[model samples]
Target: MPHGKPGQAGSFTLGPASGDVNTAYRYRLTSGSFDSGWSAYKPGATATIAPVPPTSGTMVLFAEAKDNYAAGAANSVEFVVKEGDGPVARWNFAETSGAALDTSTTDQSLRDNAALAGGAVRTDRGRRGEVTVTRATETTPAVKSTDSGLKLNGTTDYAVTSGPVIDTRASYTVAAWVRMDVPTRNATVFGQKGVNRSPFYLGYEHTSKKWSFREVNTDAAVGTPFSYQRVESKRPAVPMVWTHLAGVFDAVNNTISLYVNGELQGTTPFTTAWAATGPLQIGRVHWSSVYSDYFPGVIDEAAVWQEALTDTQVAEESELIDAHAVPSVELVTAWTPAGAQGTTLRDTVSGYGSDLALSSGASLADDELVLNGTTGAGTTAGPVVDDSGSFTVTTQAVVDAAKILSKPDGYKAQILGQRTATGSSWSLWFEKTGTRQEPELDENGDRIVDENGNPRTTPVPVGRWHFGRLTADGTGASVESMEEALMDTETRLTGVYNARHRTIQLYLTSDQQASDGIAYTAQVGTGELAVGKGYLGSWANFLPGRLSDIRLWAGALSDSKQVSDVVGT
Candidate 1:
């Protein structure tokens, strides 16, 4: 840091003190409040950071030199500076209800700028979407800290500013963290709504199968046909995954460009430009004078700059937001056979000592947990579920249905469960319900009648596995499978609870579609989560079987197509 005099040029030059040919450097500017995050590491030449306005008039510069093997400690210096420009408009979407409060100082009256509509709402359940290469630790690239953002249902949900927020015809930039749920055609994430067509649309484009930042090259004229050209990202759009998108229009450069996760994608040379003087719309598109292509996901940390953002600044912005990505869906715990040891079933996902103790003479058969009907295999280690939120559980088990207690309908058993003493939260059950009585079938598929040639109305076991949910208020329901396994023929079961939709669904390997389930609307009950047993007042409803490879997730799996990949439908 040169510590240049006040009013001097604000650009700071960063140079490596010592380095090899492969050495690279990354730098950032911060004051105590606002930070410029970090820029992309560049090799060889020096890196320059122009004035990134801080809330205060001071800025702190930090630089780090790194090679393939090692990284140097960050060296920083402080500087007092003059004024600089900030975002023209910014929304954190931190509000739980009401409009998005514009935090930018563009104008004090524009504070309550964007209004929520069509059931669009704010949620603390925000940050990045659920997609990670593996279980993340503190040092991984995946974000650990959580953030808040806006949630939108695909049908009719959006947010619109009272007026236009940017100049479309001039050099400008827009950026946001988008988590798309559905790959709807031409779904718009953010743009300025125009009378004939939007000036810019940042969203997932179904035709190209990519996250795109598109700018309409022309607008519809009176009585003339409406036509326009645009630009889009090259990276494929990943549904239910969080990624940053930045659309840049450089009038001086005569081009429009887009960035995905801070990496610059392809650019398009453009000359035609128009001003669409309409309110800024989030999660929707207005094309051909029609309002549709509504976004089907979440948008957070949305912002717009009056000038085109440099590649370094865009990278910094992506890094800044990525650090706070919330992983809503994760494997909270996995109790596998490999983790079996003396007196315990270790959580394979975490580590040793974090295990479910084997008690009441519970034994292991080839590393699989073997428990008797009355002897439960419970855990005090993890209540793997957030009883009130979404969850998915899977287990490979061989059950002896003959050991299960009988009911008037038939035999019933609780395979896996987690609940409080007052009520049940969720459970996987094997139930035999009353099905219609029909004549017995012969080996040739013909009805086998008894005496007098009359068809006999014999009963059949309608036994099936199910996923059920019980609220603390005593309201509950289950989704039963269509498969029959009443005679010790069960091998595996999968259960899912989607808190957002308030449904408990079950899936079987033979089924091609997810089963329709009853509404599970209620608050989460308090208690420890366990395997191979259900709990009410005491340790009862124990499952007698070989249980292993138990996996648990904090969030529910998606539809049949997405979940089939996991549950192996």
Candidate 2:
């Protein structure tokens, strides 16, 4: 008898011919031969094995053969398990030629069928597999100004129905892009009212040529007022040009920062405490139940962030917006030489000389003068000089004579002199008597004469000198001169004269009335008056020269030191 192994899934034959000796064969899926179990089939019979389910690990297959003989008589036959006769093992394509096999026959067959149908087999390898998906919420879409709000004929304006509210208790940064088809004239861009009924807002006025930030407090019956700050950019407001505007409010820090075209223009502090209000209004503000200061421009992409943006981020945003719009002005300019002196001191002839002399360290090439500290001891040379106490010029000849003053034209005169028995002590002097003074032509044009017809004469002290000063305090010309002496009996001089001349001049007694003996000629030099006055301030001399770097304030200097420091002689 012959026996076959189970589950081998292949045919086996075990029969002997009539002339051949009797033989038997057996086959089995032995543990060593077919560890992964197999099914057997009869000779000339077809059998199929179902596809194995996908498994993670490994698979193996084997088959065995044996010879059997009857009990009464011994029988033998050679038997063998051929390679194709055993169960077929599977493996991956990558491992098929190596240690493992492709056990997924169904997949392999499907790929083969696809290829036969003229389709390529695609293995989605190295791709991100199966990801969880999410859907976005519907945001309130913002309309571009160019699309909706910008098409109006002139001064088109719009308000946002829904936007983030600014909280006074917290800090915030607001930014926007704007292009005015017509000038804004004077209007507000953004604003909010505080709980204290105060109005704080940012606005631009074309007529005034200013961009202003106003914080108005309505606390007192008369409304106690204060100016937190205001700033104006150098560029003029131009039509059809986009400008970037930004404002940052840090209530806790009490600071307000303003930015134009991504650059910080100004910063100030909030003097009064901030009061709470809901949302800030954009494009308009209500004052006394009227919508005033309406913005007239195309405002697009307005944003309000809780945090202040860094300078780099602001610049990046500016660049991004500029790419889409034309800027109103050139961002930078090449260096060029100026035509005349950069600054002019108006009153160069006044005895109260500001240190407007040029310093050695200064240069026309760079157009800069270094002030403050320099090596020279007395009145270091510069374009400006401050004065201390009073300045005076005594001799009527110095005033009445033709003194070619070195000063900017169109300046006024101030003369300080005195008339007394012990030599005129000190008295304020001005151009009292002179013809052709209105259209003051030159240094030689001024003269002093007595209306008393006493032959304008010099007082008793011929050698005494008085003080006078010409000042250009960033305004029109002014002359200040005075002479004071506590002991002398004051003489009321009948005639005094001054001139607004371009060149400072020295005079001789011959230039005065023949009766006066006082000599007007420069004591130290031929054409220069020694600028020194004892007990008054530093004494020095200034000849006719260029004067520059002049400043004048409406109010007097804040401190005595400031005046002394500026006019250190």
Candidate 3:
């Protein structure tokens, strides 16, 4: 037996009608004691069972055939019925023959009038135009993905109806998965639009390349193309990509909102009283006006709800449409200073064995790891060799003059740096030289020449916290700093190096100061990654501040969104 929802009419077919051409068939159904007597015998044909009342459990249907040739055997099949509040009409286009099946009990099946124009061809769950029509006809385009969708020809293609299939007085949601075949022109994706009445329209405008929503109402001013309230997405929609577009009209909040890929794009006030009195049309505003704005794209999984959907519901439906829209990034490492002394700060993403060792003078205090500036106070780990050439390192540090982190460099050194100047290096410190305070720079903005002709650097102030980040890309190395004199104690710093984009970004959380797009040459080094103290003060010097929440990413966080996602915390 075929599957059906409760309160829906059941349909059954027994094909390969064999033997005598004059054969006849009889059908009956039974559920417990309730039974329908065998129907009068007739020519071999499929049966359209009457709509059964909402039911549960199982119903048995039997069929037997007979004719002037001979008597045929009997066969039976059982059907399981389910009860629920489902869609008014759901056309998955899974039918192989006949009109598109209405999967809902309400039986709002789309009226298929293929004979009036070019017929539609069905393949798998998708339907498309088999021939070009002189008159307007509905055309479903082929979708490249798994789920089937409908395609429109921008002009002279649309689905029209004599009456509205959906009615809404207060709240409603209309959503669909759409992909634009032509992005240079404006077009309507779906609506019940006529010259004067429409509940809503979800479409795109070529001028701004943005998804827009419009709900018909006479109260709105007449100067606009749409008399109803309108809201366009803040972010423009990209062409040729599958996007889930939805519009929610909420009378309770007097707001009409637009959403793309489940993210709320924009909301506008919609206080005018409204009702859709015209017929529904898909792909175009109407069949009579096919020359007007018509959608030129593939549309699928369209749904209309009488109630405004929540964000979570919209998100869930978007997932059912496509899961590849937002890609996931892999994290490399995460470290916190809240653990006990000598506890290992493990790498969260991969290679946990490369954990940092919490050692000497590095004591856990006030929920942070304090480095004594003298002796060995910090964490150390073996080398982290990355071939990707892209990396993001973030740390929250509380320092006072001493080195914050070092690779293998020795004494008289700044906070973060490699042994040689040619290697990727970074530093954050107060004093450049405690004993012999160096001048900051010469008149040419170059380091002052020392007695030996080597450039002499200046020393920053001491006794306060400072944030600094330095990154190297293909062009060169760039540095950003938040000086102690300008910021309060402690600060969060994020450094990102993206070789592909040839950009570096630094975020100073203390003041929310972001130094973005600092042109820098890219450099890929083979040195292992390390934290805190380098060579002894007799060598390089240990960090003299606290460090907390150290994290590393393998890929370049090239965008502001990626940067905010990481540094926001």
Candidate 4:
């Protein structure tokens, strides 16, 4: 009878035309009774099949005989709405072409029959055509031993599984967050091929605690290493502290950049062109089976991109990382109140203005100010200002007071002196300043004089109005100076100070022509000096201008550099 019946009741099969069989046929859904007449099957045919709504339990399909049109031919298919209907399709990696490596085992396998009917395929896992790469996790190398609480042995090398291969000829950026149990040995974190078999790499070394970026030029008969720059952390990397690191190569600009904790720390130029072949590896050197310089730490959130990140993006990322790593702390500067003894105001500059008022019971003579758990004291004699207007005289005493007052145990002071036309050349002294005399003086007044009896007057030049900072640590101090004019000559002296009471007297001799004769000049002001006393002084005509910022510390500042920072010449 040469008769034909539907393959499956609901399934329809279209016949190809005698000559043109490649044309596609379209299908659409139609509204009709389940028992409607069968549609013709032909080339370029279009058919409409209505779907059974969920409310309907199931849909049955039957086929009518064709070719001679025989009736009552039993060809029917049934589909039921049951809990389990085997997956529509499964994927097999072995059957898939271009799969470099596939790791699927057990009855549910990537090679034999792995379900793909539900989700998209992972491209990196050699399953891209089906789905986009959504998420991935890279684990740190296993640890071998512990050195100073840091893992000592672990592989850092890795191979790109699948995705866009790194093109050295193109620009790219790489970033990662690392928490080393121990410092990394000089080793490669990441790198790829460049011109003449040269490779660009970002790495760190435990010995120096420095991170470096370099390019290897194998073009030389002997391989040549071209280092851009190495950045050493100002402070040593603490154990287990996660540090964020990043590197970027701009092929267009011929520049390479590096960032730490989102902060761009170093950059270099790449005059030579980059090659296009080598595989991307992390933690270990490329193509090396032995893992010697492996990173021994935890790494999270590593990323690579084809474009350089903007400075704003980098800063934002750095801030985000900092927030996650160290959070912020509230910083407050205040002063102790007068009459209340130890009571201190939350805001010293706010309540007392420029004058840090101490309680009457507080001893200004002690050269110290105790406020909010911080203690600061004066180092020299000039720091002392009595009820009487005159200041005691002594170069050593004045410098000492400046030092101690600059970084008081709990407070800091700013220099308010201006450049006087007097021929007396005084150098600004701080830790870094090359001035001869130490700003701090010992109990013996002889400290300022060298064996030669010279005044040790390499005047730390203070050309313009500026403030010097003195940071105190226990009995030591560090000094830093800042001024508006670059021509300002200032020396920094950082050293220890003794916060004892001593009167500062400014001497005016006719020949010296030093003193401007005002009984109470605007230049002098008073506040905390030593722990027990506060100072009050009137400049008179000696130097005109209101005393600006006066502060005292509870502890001694002994660092010579710190002292120089407190008062610049």
> Judged by lDDT, which candidate is best?
1
RMSD of each: 20.4, 40.4, 24.8, 29.5
Tens-digit lDDT track of model 3 for 1-569: 33554435567765325653434556666633224444433555544456352344577766666556665667788777654233444444444454444454443454321111123333322221111122223686433322244556676665554566566566777777665664657788767644554556788877777889877665233354445677887656654435667888877788888877666777888777466556556666532333356777666556666656655456555544222222222244666666544556555533233466666665666767676666544444322323223456677766554242322222222344322133333333333312225566867876677789877764433332222222222222444454432312566666665443345666666233345556544432323344565432123445666677776644445455545644565
Give lDDT per model, in order.
0.66, 0.32, 0.52, 0.33
Candidate 3: residue 55 Cα off by (Å): 27
**Candidate no. 4 TM-score:** 0.31
TM-scores for every predicted model: 0.45, 0.29, 0.38, 0.31
Rank the candidate models, highest lDDT first.
1, 3, 4, 2
Question: Over the stretch 37-108, how does candidate 4's per-residue lDDT look in tens digits?
Answer: 544544344334443222122444443333323332324444553321111221222233232132222343
Residue 482 in candidate 4, Cα distance off native in Å: 27
What is the clash tally of candidate 1? Answer: 0
Q: Which candidate comes out best when scored by TM-score?
A: 1
